[model samples]
Target: MEKEKIDAAQESSPGITRRGFLQTVGIGTLEIAVVGAVAPAVQAETRQRGNLVPLTLKVNGQRHELHVEPRWTLLYVLREKLELTGTKPGCDRGECGACTVLIDDRPRYSCLTLALEADGHEITTVEGLMHGEQLGPVQEAFVQEDGFQCGFCTPGQVVAAEGLLRHTANPDIGEIRTGMSGNLCRCGAYGHIFKAVQRAAILRK
Candidate 1:
């Protein structure tokens, strides 16, 4: 009698087997769980986007007051907003020193630094290392020593060299290598780069 009732229900609901019904229920439950897990994250991101905060950044001796998202990186603000393309975006991670900049006279990876974290700090880029129409000593040294090839990484290299020299006015060959170890030259321009740092030291003196 029970089997007959079960068969009758199956016949009434054509194409709906027990297994198919269970599968549908299982899929629906999984989808609900996924939505429940993802909805909060999506809503939080939306809220963050809606809440833009005011930021004050001191760049290359100029002060900029602007609104920026909390998640924005210093690299993006520099290159995209301020049009300081001298800070190259390489690897978009700390691994590549192509986005190096000076924060409080220390070398920092701009790509890894948050725009908010740099608030009220002295920031310097390759473009700031100029005097009117003349290149800074480090930039001139790079040119005179032929320290770059392709020139994509030249900006970061120059900034890093400048920061290195700020603390150590005269770095020996070993100190130069160690100071510049964080920056890389894909063109294998280490020899020229080292020479450039030495030349920059002399020029600064």
Candidate 2:
């Protein structure tokens, strides 16, 4: 009986089956790798949460105060915390310019801009361009020229165009192209967008 039991135990051992052995090893390796990758990020994120600082922003002439993690971006604060959703996060890396907002009267990519960096600066969003239910000329021109198709990029385009027109009262074609170059319309509305810029300049004057 003892010999028969020993033979059964050896035959049914976990290491006896190659597939089961490999699976156990693979699961252990994956767990170690996942821990290695996630532990550091969790530690850093916890540290950031512990160091949440007070941030004040003058957005669209309104003052906002909040305690934000150091790692939070301006776009996240604007859209998530402040409920200002006009700024789109098309490319969070600042390449698409879809999350553009006016920082101290200059167009800046909000996603790439940290909320702490925007402190004490005058921040303007697309919502700032309105006059108590009246649209600014830049927005009006965009609508008149049908400057978009899906309208996802319109807010950023309008904000960027408004910034450009503010600096150059009458930007020529070359200047218009250069100034508006940072913004992109995925709908291929470049022609109408160009016309809108020209018309916005005229309207502003």
TM-score of each: 0.77, 0.77
lDDT of each: 0.92, 0.89
Q: Which stretches of candidate 2 lie over 4 Å from their true place?
A: 1-46
Kindly report which residue pairs in candidate 2 clash with one another.
none
Provide the lDDT at 29 for model 1: 92
| lDDT value for model 1 | 0.92
Ten contiguous residues minimizing lDDT sum, candidate 2: 14-23
Candidate 1: residue 144 lDDT (0-100): 99
Question: Per-residue lDDT for 28-144 in model 2, tens only?
Answer: 997787787998767876888899999898999999989999889999999878878889999789887789999988999999999999999999999999888999889999999
Candidate 1 residue-wise lDDT, 28-52, digit = tens? 9977876878987678768987988
Off by over 4 Å in 1: 1-49
Q: Could you tell me how far off, in angstroms, the CA of residue 100 lies in candidate 2 after the best superposition?
A: 0.7
The CA lDDT at 32 in model 2 is 84
